[model samples]
Target: MKNKKFFSAEHKKYLRKTRLNRLLISLGRWSVLLFIIGLWELSAQLALIDPYITSSPSRVAKTIIAWAKDGSLWLHSWTTLYETLIAFAISIGLGSLLAILLYLFTPVRKIFEPYLVVLNSLPKIALGPLLIVWVGAGTKAIVLMGILICIIITTMSMLQSFVAIPQEKILLLKTLGANRFQVLFKLILPHAIPDFISVLKINVGMAWVGTIMGEYLVSQAGLGYLINYGGLVFNLDTVMSGIVVLCILASLMYFSVATLEHYIHKKRNL
Candidate 1:
């Protein structure tokens, strides 16, 4: 009974520590958010900048809430999120496959490496007009644009991770009678998981960028469409609201990737 009581006390202490830590982290994050919004509100009130162009935090918040009540904001957010998720899935699936192929085949890598580099460096906005022309105006074109923006980066990052596995490890696997296919699947892909997560984090932003750019040129829905419409009509509050929503969505995606990265690293270390 004494030992049981001691164990219970220890568990309670651990729970308390975890709660405290979570609270501290939340406070830090919220403090930064509040500080930025406070500064923006103060600046606008002081007339330090034109509120018409720059907009205040309060105005942006009101605009978002207003759009939300009208269903426009939620609908647009859903459309963009759907397109982004679909593109992200395609990018990760195809990019990782291509990376593995290139990693395994010297001839394939030699032929495609330069083109991959060029494609990665190319401005995705340049493809906007062409994508709309080919895929038509709407979610499909936006998803395609996002996929193109992300695939090259994911390929390059995952390929680098695959090659980064130590040669000694490969040698050891070969001595164990593992064939090329077995070695790649059993060794390289597992080793590349952390890098792949990192690549996904990057692809999230690229996907957003591509989707937004595509919307600017095409599409009748999305936060990007809202921003374009806002600018055309000089509705600064609407534009600022769209920008805020984009920031929040991107940050959330990045945070999710970071959590996955942490989990992968912890498992690896253990």
Candidate 2:
């Protein structure tokens, strides 16, 4: 009975602490955001900063609402979202497959590893004109840009995870008469699940960056295009509104990956 009571108290304490931590995190996040918004509004109202140059939260909100009423907001947002999702899916599929191939074949890895590093290090912006010349200014160029940005990182990260797996396990599997395919499927892939999830989380942001950069170069529609147009017209509020929307969209995508990671962890634990 004493042990049962001790366990019960411990469980309650754990629950309380967890709740407190979550509350603190939420409060801190909102507090910082609110402080920044308040300061921006105050500065704008006082004319300490020109609202025309640096739009306030209110101006951004108004611009978003105006766009929404005109129906252009959804059109541009959907265009960007569609391009990003397509690129993201393709990058994950191609990257994972290529990483697996590289891991299984030493010669392939050796031949391409240096090239991957060089490509990754090269500034993507420099390739914009070439891409335009190759694919023309459209969705294809935008999607390809995002794929270029995300695929190398995914391959490098997953290849590292594959290489990091314990050699002893592979040797043991071989001793048990497990063939290469069996070892790869049952051991390497399972061990790399967490790494795959981490890559997804990171690629979400990289995909957005690439897509936005591409849109700036070639898109007739998209949040990035809106920002570019706004800048050309000196519409700071519209630019700020596009930036705000991009932030929210990126946050939502990140949280979706985090949720998937949580589900994966729960399944693995079970």
User: What are the Cα lDDT values of the candidates?
Assistant: 0.88, 0.94
Tell me the number of clashing residue pairs for each predicted model.
0, 0
TM-score of 2: 0.94
Model 2 lDDT tens row, 143-204: 99999999999999999999999999999999999999999998999999999999999999
Expressed as tens digits, the lDDT of each residue in 87-154 for candidate 1 is 88899999998988898898999999999999989987788888878878778888888899889889
The positional error of residue 228 in candidate 1, measured at the CA in angstroms, is 1.4
- Identify the runs in model 2 with alpha carbons over 4 angstroms from their true place: 1-18
lDDT of 2: 0.94
**Alpha-carbon RMSD of each model:** 3.6, 2.4
Q: What value of lDDT does candidate 1 attain over all alpha carbons?
A: 0.88
Q: TM-score for each prediction?
A: 0.87, 0.94
Model 2 residue 54 lDDT score: 100
